[model samples]
Target: MLLELFTGKCPIDECFSGDVNLPKWVQSAFPENFMQVIDSKLLVGDVCNEDHDDGDGDDDDNLYVSPEIQVEYCLATVIEIGLSCTRDSPDGRITIRHALQKLKNAKHNFLKNRNGEKM
Candidate 1:
């Protein structure tokens, strides 16, 4: 569920034929090409809503961490939880309660990071 939520891919996605399911597909892109595997929408950060530029076409010298990066960190944490839940052995997998707590932490951290950056 976490993998599907973050990566925007399903186990039965058409691209996942043969033995390649959502978890494997995401794993292949892990640790390096993760940005490619995740939902591109998450990175846009309001490119469609309005122009947030300060006319420099660059960083604009803002001190806050961009929302895009925060989402990426949150996504990475969620994906890790998904992978942990899908481990080959039941012993290796995290319990549902544990996963829930970790997810809550990830969300808390994401919100905290965003709030901290703004202040």
Candidate 2:
């Protein structure tokens, strides 16, 4: 689910190579070109853009949340979680509890930054 959010590609539909999976593909490109792996829509801040017509045939009201540093941090956190969860060895993988905690922390930080609260 997190991987889908970042890459905007369904793993079952897009990643089919026997030698590599979605997580591996993301991991390989993350170190250098992380933005390239992210969904273009996300990079363009399209998720929050809503088109609403205000009676007068004027579609001037558009709501958008521009991508910021917090977005990058959140993406990085989720990518780390995805990588941890997809480890080849079960022992190397993080438990659900740990993953949840990490997610919560990321969410907290994102919200904090969004609110302009000091960390």
Candidate 3:
């Protein structure tokens, strides 16, 4: 649920081929080509309404996050967590407590960076 919120796409909808699973598809693009896998809609800053344009020329503030380094770090952290949760071996999977801790740390780091705090 959280993964979908962050990624903005259903894995089943994006990677539903017989030969590939969502995790594999995502893993293939990680570290080197991670940006290619992110949702483009999340990068848009402002959206214009075609039908309700009153010629006022005001930009509509849509929900968007910049692809800055800090944002990328946060995204990478979440992706790593997802990968950990989806591991083939049960022994390799992380516990819910550990996952939540990781997420909290990632959020903290992201917020710290966003607030101009040194690491």
The regions of model 1 sitting more than 4 angstroms off are: 47-64, 117-119
Candidate 1 backbone collisions, by pair: none
- The model with the greatest TM-score is 1
TM-score of candidate 1 against the unseen true structure: 0.75
Question: Residue-wise lDDT of candidate 2 within 57-107, one digit each (tens)?
Answer: 544334223335568778888888988888889999999999999999999
Model 3 misplaced regions, further than 4 Å: 45-67
Q: What range of 10 consecutive residues in model 1 has the weakest lDDT sum?
A: 45-54
lDDT by residue for model 1 over 6-118, one digit each (tens)? 77887788999888998898899886778788887666655232224445566843645566667777888888899999988999999999999999999888888666534
The TM-score values for the models, in the order shown, are 0.75, 0.72, 0.72
Model 3 poorest ten-residue lDDT run: 46-55
Of the pair 1 and 3, which is ahead by lDDT?
Answer: 1
- Between which residue pairs do clashes occur in model 3? none
lDDT for 25 in candidate 3 is 67
Worst 10 residues of 2 by lDDT: 58-67
